[model samples]
Target chain A: MILETKNLSIGYSAKNKSKILQSSLNLKLKSGNLVSLVGPNGVGKSTLLKTLCKLIRPIEGEICIKGESLESAESNALAMVLTQGIYAHGFTVFDVVSLGRYPYTNWIGKMTAHDVQIIENAMASVHIGHLAHQSAMQLSDGEKQRMMIAKALAQETPLIILDEPTSHLDLVNKIEIIHLLHQLSRQHSKAILMVTHELDLAIQNSDEMWIMSQEGIQMGCPEDLILDGRLQRLFQSNQIVFNQDQLHFQRNHLLSKPIWMKSNSDGLAEKLSFQLLQKLGYYLEAGYKDCQLELLSNQTWQITKNNSVFQFENLAGVQDFLRNN
Target chain B: MTIRILLLSILFVVLSLLSLLTGSVWISPSEIYEALTNPQLNVVNHFIFTQLRLSKTIAAIVVGMGLPISGLMMQTLYRNPLAGPFVLGISSGASLGVALFVFAGSSLLALSPWLLSLGLGFFAILGAFLVMLLVLTVSISIRNSASLLVVGIMVGSLSTALVSVMQYYSSPQLLQRFVVWTFGSLGGIHWNEIIVMTLVVSFSIVFSFGLMKSMNALMINEDYAKGLGIKVNYLKIKMIVLSSLMAGIITAYAGPIAFIGVAIPHLARNFIHTSDHRKTLPIVLLLGSNMMLICDLISQLPGGTTVLPINSVTALFGAPIVIWIVIKNRSFLNS
Candidate 1:
């Protein structure tokens, strides 16, 4: 195991008072594995990650990195990518990324040839090599995030931790970042852990999952955790429900009357019609005698109910027709 | 980068020479060179050159090098562009210390001049240390850099007000002395005072160089710096002490020369085109020294017999540069 925490309790302590966020965290992360920590907001996911990175001291228990106590492990043993953005002005992407060599650089921080090579490799790994000359402040959020990840990669530690790496990114960028981290774990054999709100993406990409909630901590493979209903319990709410088969979340909407859906072609119009109906809180049956909906391949829709038939050119028209009827 | 550094070094030499030649005395460049090279030939000119202009030039260099570097450290520590020795009231704190001692009466002044200056230096450091402590404490509670800046301004106002109350209660002689000190003269420092100031500033600069790596890490984010294994609190305290010492010592000698601390780092960053202190620190040092020399030259008022205050000269020159930087980098500042 690259990292293991036994009976860890994480929280803030000031003066004579201490507040514990989570306790009894028995976690293990191995090389060549990507793990995601998912939990409800304020469930101490960040606290746990911070404790693991040694940014904040744990109130109780022990954290071991590569069989050594966390306190004994050098700072270069673990790399961290934080959520807070860089505030340093006028720094280029290369300058920011090269700072990862802080541990190896001399007192004046003169980068060695080997350190420069690692920096280049890191930027290339994140596909930001072309942007090395560009000022970091001018980069888009997604690009900046990738550069930050490259910095962590340049640290060349056995373990890497990221806090909400994909929080502000668009869907494509989010997938891209998670995919890059996933590849890093598999190809480089680095133990990677990320705190994320992207549940489906995390579940799909992560080899293991650490779910934190009111029930404390549950650790296992994503699939196992899903099967055991651990994820469901962690994210359960009045308005949203976790869909195990779909590997995503769906709103708990009130059900409408069931309708039969039929299509002339198994194409875009057919799939879109079913989605529209489901979104309108209607359940589709394979066939129903009293109510039937037909989607023609010519981008038309027809609804037949109780011996009446309505024809419309588009889905919106069909919705209007249904509302009038 | 090498070319830029070379150009800046050349500019620094030319400015230092110009400062030496452009005083109230009508000494030509050749005569000044001769006086510098052959000190035995002209005793009166030698006194004017060494005791007056040379000391003033060294004082400017020391103040220039010290303030900008201190400003750079404070800016990085607070992550605020406007943070500097003067803006954050560190100079004012030094002023308060000096004011208390100088206005206390003539008994202390009756002692040896060297002893008197040393006493003032000690008080200035105490005052600066107190203000640094207060600013750091307030910064802990306040996350916004701009708000901390406001707090600093408030602290400066309070110190100035305290100085004013002390001035009002003092004799006319003491009040004039305090007012002239506030005007900030570079011409009055002797070789002994300049040596002490140089030593203090050099120590701080060397200490800051050692902190370049941690400061670079800090620029990214504090948590990231910590994650990289930087001892954040230890580095912070060290920076505070170093910055205070530099600013305090310079203020004690130069009477709180303004704006160089706040402006020079920005100017250096613009010239160097990078915020990485590894590259920016040297540029800041050279540029700061150059700026101080230029300000001192302008303060001499060229054809006039009366010399202008160094503080006014620096403000007139420094404030506009700061404004231009703010305008040019509006987006970066907002970010």
Candidate 2:
């Protein structure tokens, strides 16, 4: 096990008093594992991560790293990636990554040949070797995220913790980062943990999932959590609900405005129109007389409502026409 | 980079020579050589060389090196581009010390030149240290850097207010003395005070180099630095003490030279396109020294008997460079 916490209580302490957020928690993280911590807002996910990183003191209990108490472990043995983006003005991608070697470098931080090799390998691992000399500010958000991950990799620690690593990324980049993290865990045998709001991606990519709420935390494999109904209770709201069939969350509202959907051919276009109508809060039906949508194979949508037929070149046009009618 | 360092060194040497040659009394190179090697041949030039021009040159070098380095440290410590050495009220503290000495302590001490200089430097350093101690105590309780900045500004204002009230009630002769000191001169420091300033500035700057890596980490992000096991608070306090010592001692001997502290670090960053202190530290030191020498030479007005205040000359010379660099390289703001 790379990390383990026993009966841990975390919170803030003032002059003579303390405010405890959560207590009596036992957690374990092992090598070659990718764990995603998903929780509602204000559930102390960040506070817990801070406590693990030793940024703040835990109100009670013990956190051990590699079988050693946290306070006794060598500080160089642990590494963390934070949510805050760096200014990185006038710094190249290489310079920023080289900062991860701060623990091993001398006082002046002069890089040895070994350190140089490690930095190069880190950049190559993230596929940013081409951008080694480019200013960090010029990279796209996704590229910057990769650079930060590479920085943590260069730290050469057995364990790595991240806070919302993919918070600012687009959909494709978000999945790509999670996939890369998963690969890093298995390939390098490093224990990787992250706090994220990407539930679907986390379920798909992480080896284990930690679902946290105000009541407490539940840790298990993604399938086990879903089977035991733990994932269903992760959020407390009637407007949103966990969909068992799709393995994701969806709005539980009574989908209004029943509209019949049809197409000449059962292909990508027809399936897309069907999904779109269902997503826009319309109860999708087949062969209904009152309202009808005919998605043609010629990239046009025909909507028949109240005995008036409206044709459009796209799904957006169909939505606009239906809303007006 | 090596070439730039070499060029800066050459320029510094040339400027030092020019500054030595450019005073109210026109002393040529040969005459200077004679004054140094064969002192008996030209007694007047020898006295002027060792007593006036040399001390002034060394004083300019000390202030130039000290202020910008402290300013760079301040900017890094606070993670603020606009921070300078005196932002924490060190200058104001030095001023209050001088004011109290002129307004009150003058009657208590003998009017000998040696005693006056020693007393002024001692009291100014004491005042600066006292302010630093108060700031250090307050900083222990305040975790936020912005709040520390606010506290520093408030302390500066409070000290300035006290000095103004003291000025309003002072005798005319005493007021004139205090006002002249505030105008600031690189020429007023004698050999005795110059040695102390040089030693303290050198020590502080050399010590700063040892922490350059930690400073870089802190500048990137404070919490991240903490997670890396850096003692952030200790680093901040060390920076504060070093900056105060350099600013305090220079203000005492040379009367609060300005512009160099705030502007030199920016100039280095603009020219080098990097804020890595390992790279910029040497550049800032060289540029700062050159600027001081240039400003002092301008103030002296070689052929004329009248001299301008060093404070005005630094602003007049430095402000335009800053404006030009900022306008030309607008990305400096990002750095």
Candidate 3:
């Protein structure tokens, strides 16, 4: 392993006995593999990444890069080989990525021809070569995210760590980012670790995944996780049931009755109903009873003649009031 | 590199001549240069150039170059454009130290001039160092630049208040000397004082160069600097120490020249657009030295031989340049 943490306990040591941000978190990254860390909110994913990067001093464990203790390893030497790109503010796309060459730079901080070439190559790697000279403040959120990744690539570090890299990205941007990480792992041989919410993409792309749970962190392959039933346990939400074959969650039962308008249009109301459900994570399926829509969690729709009734396991009685009346 | 150094040295020489020739004495340029070169042949001319003109000329160049470089270091370390030795209470600290020394009267002044200067330099450096350290600590603890600024200004006002108390206790004879010192005279600094100024400024500049890379990283972000193996806390302390030392020594000799530190580096920035200090610092020294020499010369106004305070002269020239730059920066940011 190029980078590994041994029985690591992560968090601030400000007060006594407060070292349990995430405990028993042992992780290892080989020289050139992509790994993603996925967990629910407040599960210490960021804390784990920061711990591995040595940004915050971890409590009650050792982190080693290339068999050397992280703390004892020389910062300058570690800087050249193991680096993370962090966003400060308002640096140009070029200006920011150029900072990756700082370790090789002289006291004057002048970039040589070789350094400039590397920054260019890094920008090209992320397909942000056109925005090289543009200010980062001008770029769209997706573009800026890519620019940040370009900066990490420019560092040319063997081990790269990212925290919630695709938190606010759209679906397309999310896929592109995962692809970019995949490219770096395969083509560039960078040991990539990213914290993400996209479990499906991570499970497919990663060689290993570390499941950070309230009980403890467990490491295994995607297939191993599925075989062991940890995958189902990981995303344990009552609203939907996961299909192992298709890798999607489906509504467990019927919601309100499906509204039939000549049985011709389901697209428009389906979109509107889905959007309304998103507001409170509850939605009405189309059912028949004076064109009524009701809220449900394990939502499904049973279509009737013209009216609709939504179904819920427990809240179905109260939420189905409109149809009942 | 040798050529650049030589050019600056020559520029210093030319300014010295202009400083002597441009005054109310109105010595012709030829007579000025000839008299300046062959001083032994002309006793009266020697007194004018050596005792009066040369002393002031050297003091202006030294403090001008010294103060701004100190200011540049402060700005780089603190990562604030408004930061400088004087504006942020570093110079006021030195002024407070001087006020104490001047209030103590002739007995303290009777100590070896270097001892008195060192006495003044130490406390001034201590005062400035304390303020810089406080600003650094507050800035780090809060991680906010604007609040540190308000704190710095309050610190300066507090130092001013301390000096005022000292001024109240001083005798009229000592008071006059103190007031004269406060006016910031390049005119009274002797050859020995100039030597001290040169030695202190050169040494501080050399020491500050060692911190160039750290300062560059700091310019990007504090976290970036820390990540790059620079101990951010240690780098800040050393910058504060070096800046205070240079400001303290110059203040000891030249009595707190105003605006040189605050204004010249802005001009240097306009000249050298790069945020890199290796390029920025040398240019700051050159422009600062030039501005002080010109200010010293322009200070010879037509007031029936009533000379204006050099601080007032510097404030007059320096304030507008700084104001213009600030205004220009506002527009630059907006557009």
Instruction: State TM-scores per candidate.
Output: 0.96, 0.91, 0.83
Instruction: Go through the candidates in order and give each one's C-alpha lDDT.
Output: 0.88, 0.84, 0.72
DockQ of each: 0.82, 0.63, 0.28
Residue-wise C-alpha lDDT for candidate 2, range A1-325, written one tens digit per residue: 9899999999899999998888887999999999999998888899999999999999999999989999977767677888887866667889888888988888999999999999999999889999999998789999998998898899899999999989889998998999999999998999999999998899999999988887778999988998888887887678888877678887775678788987786577876786777777788767787898887665888888889888899888877776667
Candidate 1: stretches off by over 4 Å: A242-245, A285-290, B29-41, B329-335
Per-residue lDDT for B1-335 in model 2, tens only?
A: 89999999999999999888878888999999988999998899999989999999998898999999988987786555655756677677877887777788557556776677777777777777777677667866874555776887788889889999999998887788788888899986788789878988999999999888888888887877776778888998788778878888888889977668878998888778888888989999999999999999989886799889999998886677656744655564434
lDDT per residue, candidate 1, A116-199, as tens digits?
999999999999999999998889989999999898999999999999999889999999999999999988899999999998
Q: How is the predicted docking of candidate 1 categorized under the CAPRI scheme? A: high
The best candidate in terms of lDDT: 1
Q: Is candidate 2 or candidate 3 better by lDDT?
A: 2
Q: By DockQ, is 1 or 2 better?
A: 1
Residue B314, candidate 1: alpha-carbon lDDT: 94
Flag clash pairs in model 2: none
Better-scoring candidate (TM-score), 1 or 2: 1
Model 1 chain A: ten consecutive residues of lowest lDDT: A243-252
Clashing residue pairs in all predictions, respectively, total: 0, 0, 18
Poorest stretch of ten by lDDT in candidate 1 chain B? B326-335
TM-score per candidate for chain A alone = 0.94, 0.92, 0.75
Query: For this target, which candidate reaches the highest DockQ against the unseen true structure?
Result: 1
Model 3 lDDT per residue over B230-305, tens place: 7877887788878988898888768777778878877777664455576677878777887888888778874346
TM-score of chain B of 2: 0.87
